[model samples]
Target: QPVTEEPSALAPPAAKPKSAVFYRHLRLDFPAIVRGEGSYLILDDGRRILDASGGAAVACIGHSDARVGEAIMSQIKSASYCATLLYTSTVCEQLCRLLVDSTNGQMARAYIVCSGSEAMEASLKLARQYFLEKTQPEPQRTHFIARHQSYHGNTLGALAVGGHKSRRLPYEPILSTNVSHVSPCYAYRGKKAGESDAEYVVRLADELDAEFQRVGPEKVCAFVAEPVVGGALGAVPSVPGYFKAIQAVCRKYGALFICDEVMCGMGRTGSLHAWQQEEGVFPDIQTYGKCLGGGYQPIAGILASHEIIDTISKGSGAFVTGHTYQGHPVSCAAALAVQHIVAEENLLANVSELGPYLGELLTKRLGDHPYVGDIRGRGFFWGIELVEDKATARPFPPKANVAMEIIDLGLKGADYSVALYPGSGTADGVSGDHVILAPMFNASRAEIETIAD
Candidate 1:
């Protein structure tokens, strides 16, 4: 029997929304974003704020791209949702093929997901599953090794693997106990005096080796890291041969190497893959997002090496995970269009050409500023660390919220009309302030200068 209730004639009027749509910050009054243009966000109040950080470096191709919208609409007109468990879509196949081809066959398979966090979570699961599927069958290999002061994602699985103290503080008691963290190869703060780059690489490699030994190498599944430290470390890149050294250690310990390029991959670092720019560094599994879909439809994915995929295919005959929207057709269509634009416009060249120029300009403009401590990055990604004492590289206390204040000043200050990425807890995982500048990959010289000024 079905019961239907008619609306009461005397029903009280519905209460107001109470300002619906929960925001990231409950106390702060956020702006209403009505529209976005080329490298700019339009507010409901008619303010046009320049987007200098690409909204956490997500808008690689900028916003209001009609081509992407059209592609999305085309797919939506066809069909929006398909149960992927029993079927597949052309757009999804095309996107996967394009991703594999982009890797030049280095990565043999692609698992399309909805966000970077999903991609990373998949990577972690795949790595552990791979060990189980191998002929050796390492059921005991359950632990993961990551770096301290790094951020993977917010989900429980990703959060467990991440080492950001502030973000993990609330969930520390509930996070997975199988993950351990090692020191990040940060030259600015981690390197000892008088140590050469080669020596530093060796030293870090030794640290990884020691960690594996301490954790019982047979119990470890993989070592995960971000090729270029993103917001957690304020765009810090490792020295030459750093990754090669770390990868070697992982190989020596029978552990897989996983690189989290969610915030730094897919041409954000000038190269299509950050690992491609490195001389001899590569990953068994890699995660990418943000720029992968250019914030169009919230898409991300993981690329796996042939060896890893073959093991699973031969053993379980299928992956042990499923998501209703794992390969959404509309999202794939939008990402495909965004990727096509990235290629058709040859934006990578633009990124390569302008990256150094942007760095040079930032150095020239803010290098001598008293509060500026260190400026380091590569390609279109750059960061400016603010300090209390430049000579000592002393960061402002966490309570000061220097980075957030700079972001606010840039957005509302009469002098500088721009939006920058604010980063905190960059020093010792508790007290540090820095701002990141990740302009659009297709930014013109004038726009770059504007960001610098």
Candidate 2:
């Protein structure tokens, strides 16, 4: 009998490279990413594309970090798996503690989970559960009031709470009808010619107030919003006192305020939490992700305030939420390590110091461009809204795919090797275009200049 030889583990698999992967764009052939180093993505063809947007603003700490790798390895070698149903690992607890501490007691408890969508789903359920644990159990308070042009997540529950028309169109019939939309506090396009920030905020607040009244305030569970609107609105931050005014409406209606900071929080907006910069207003419940783990692992979690935690504690002594990998050791360890690096190196301070320069450079370079209509953001996250006519702020039609074209141009050749985050529907629900530039928090002045150039 002849001896049989097996395929070497080092060799590539026999199947077609792209066959097994279900990409976001099924019709397009995707580039193969071999590796990442610092703020650049290395392609299999030896191209080094600068990662300016950090893959939808996820990688805040950068691509390659030996510290995070070692921490993940150490956890894997010691104890990689632990069922949160039966037990909790120290790594998970530590990450939770760090998260809670980062909030400075404004948010009391942290429930660890996997992705931003998962975190948003958990938040929705938790909001409902909080109402149930009330003295009278206001179960009728199941409706959510969210802003228009917001993207919470793609999950069914999260989708229902978001108001992005294009994204919700396919599932509108199937999605829950309990959620309603109010106008977002968008200053650039929504504000009047002579409107001050205060007047704009008041007008938006009135819109929210009217929505709550129209929906029957007592029947609403919570008013959900992103402190700095991400994705759907292209990194648009609310005008001063906007959050406070909206939060007041929620309070007046005896409803909870759930802030979805999945994309804008975790120091992406120069502060660990975006709400911290919003007139000292703290949310009842906050969902966080993206830069939370700095793209080191699949980890996201919710931070519930003391008021919410106490309510559930007093009523049934239980909050109904569970996930099998809720507190996975390896994921927690990786996140913890990334956060530790963030703190030890003071990356948040770096964001604060260098963020203004990024904005200035973007304005200096792209401000007067024919296609640039608006440039707005805070911290290291900035968005450039592209338009066909800057004077009229007329967005190129969605059919043109202007946002994607800019991204394509940025990634074209070694001469223009840069990656940007593309988004649509910035002007309205269907025809706007914008691209975001969210570099690593630790990016130097030179790199920031390069990105701007």
Candidate 3:
């Protein structure tokens, strides 16, 4: 007689090999993405996932573009590395020129870096240094004012300036004390029941002004904000005249207005810079990344206004900060190629034409759903906020992990295959949830339909 086998249920699960890589979620196993084609990612298991969020709105042109790859290789063959202090490459100059030209002289200088965090860090340092270099130096100007529910980056300096509550919780003890927070221009939650757009703008602007006064206006260096907030608040755009009002407050205090376009700039909002869409709201120091390199290379930078650059040039004759990988040749080449493609292909036109359609589709599809609290965004970037109670706009508790759950299901569910960017703490920086849908700038109408569907 054959030996009787133990029941399958009685047998222990096979021991899997432990992964060597430290993941963001230690207990979860991530799917391996083998390659990308157009708007989809090909996983190792052979499933094609529609890249709806472009990997945090970075892949504006989509993945694996031959042109960008060629540019990167060409730059590598010529020169990949250089000491930024001792030398600067032609590619770096070209990239900087392209950025400054895009700003149409509003931004006079560009300082390249490896990520948005570095750009923001540089922006903060440059703001401080600018004050020190002024003809009448205000050494007392050590404070920075930023909006609540804002996310700049992960570096300590960036984190200190950021107001995302959950992201800052763990590092609160170490974050700088020089930064203070103000209310973000979130109409869905922040606006009063009977308030008009103009009224809301005034109220928020007054709050910012009061904060500056509270902090002692003369001691403030800058008022930092994202024209269209990204992860922290799920692609929330300020109402009309919001930026102008706030900029006035900054101007009144003689504080620089630093716009962080890390997730919403570079044609992601149908403008080279998000502030360009806001009338008379030019930033003194602007930080941009994400779509800057179109995910082909790791690159980011800050565009400084003429005043700040002139101040530094006259006083220090040099920026006080520097990074080892600043102005890396290959990264600059990749970014330059990406920006050129964006311009040559007229992808901004695509974004401008299709962005409203995408929004309309999302509203038609999910607007009535009890869970969809709000839908807001511009250009290729849009967000669907989820709520537990539509009547009250009540957010699910943090333990529910609603946003991540939806994202995980989208990735692994049998009915659909899509990748979305998730955000938490949307309601009060701890309980609200939202999912962003940021298709590539070159995404087709058909792809937009698929994403909305």
Candidate 4:
């Protein structure tokens, strides 16, 4: 018999990539991701991990799409960055045009911004500017009523308007003083014990209305909310008629309904915009990000309808805002390419197709598990609530580190390398935890299975 060649142990196993900085959290030995293809990250150690959360649901069309790359290169060849004040590039204008057209030409125009936070800030400022343009300069129109357990951004103003206590806790001292939060329409934990869905929605709407009244309706400029609550409370969507009711109340108070679809918009909710499916409700101001550029570039925007734009354009003749990178040439080109692919390739239909399938798989696998409590979401975005006890709906103590454990398990398990984002204090504002799975927009059925498993 031929002697088997002894395995050479010359090469020691490679070291795992480490996080750049660690303050007090766990010492993480993160993998060095060298490349991304479709819906997977290729680590330096030759391991392939399915990107489940996409670094917080930003990778919509998946990695390394040539169209987006070419577009970026094209813009780079032309000009990488241009001052928004002095010039408006074709790429930015076209990106806006595509967005407005996709909204069925209902939207007036897009205010390009660098991040979701910037867009939210623009939304806030634009609402104020709109009032000034309309000659209804109510100084009292300064308060913002947003939903609890929702995330806007990490920036100061967005964080202030956000209701995520954990994100806001550290900066509470310096955050804005003009914002107040109301209960989110999170039915799994927020809906009343015996109330019908409609009744629960009505009551929540009433609660929001009451908050506005308490703040003085004339003083409030906008009511902000993610059509689907994001990482702060998992992918929790409002019950049917909830948005309609909220919209009605906003109209009643003459406040701008600012829908922050940052996490849920741009086809994440199986529609181009989440509000499009909600009957009888269209936001006067809407912010979008993440999937807007399909993760091809850092692009976010605020959409103003004809009413707001006409008011601003005629009254002020200029929006009171500016950003050096507001409409960068390369970013806009990448975004334009991404949006074009999303439409030309019909990826939104894919989102609608795979979103429910992923939901079903998550429910079937974890719904009956003792640790799993609720499975809720829409489109490709979904969330899983973990409970220590289903009967009591009691959450694992924050010290237990439930969601982080699952994430570690996922990384360890060869079946998948999907990420699990942990949300603390999801219930009420001080308790409850969840995991969100927002796969790529173009993920196939098999990729979805790998992610779910």
Per-model TM against the reference: 0.94, 0.95, 0.95, 0.93
lDDT tens digits, residue span 175-261, model 4? 989999888887878776898999998899899889987999888888999888888888988899999999999999999999999
| Residue-by-residue lDDT tens digits, candidate 1, 231-298 | 89898889999999999999888899999999999998899899888788879999999998999988
For model 2, what is the alpha-carbon lDDT of residue 222? Answer: 92
Worst 10 residues of 4 by lDDT: 1-10
lDDT of 1 at 385: 87
Task: Provide the overall lDDT of each model, using Cα atoms, as 2-decimal numbers.
Answer: 0.87, 0.86, 0.89, 0.83
Residue pairs with backbone atoms closer than 3 Å in model 1 (clashes): none
Q: Which ten residues in a row have the lowest lDDT in candidate 3?
A: 1-10
Clashes of each: 0, 0, 0, 1
Question: Which candidate has the top score in lDDT?
Answer: 3
- Model 3 RMSD vs true structure: 5.9
Candidate 2 clashes: the total is 0
Q: What TM-score quantifies how close candidate 4 is to the native fold?
A: 0.93
Q: Candidate 2, which ten residues in sequence have the lowest lDDT sum?
A: 1-10
Report how far residue 106 has shifted in candidate 2, in Å: 1.0
For every candidate structure, what is the RMSD over all alpha carbons to the true structure, in angstroms? 7.7, 5.7, 5.9, 4.0
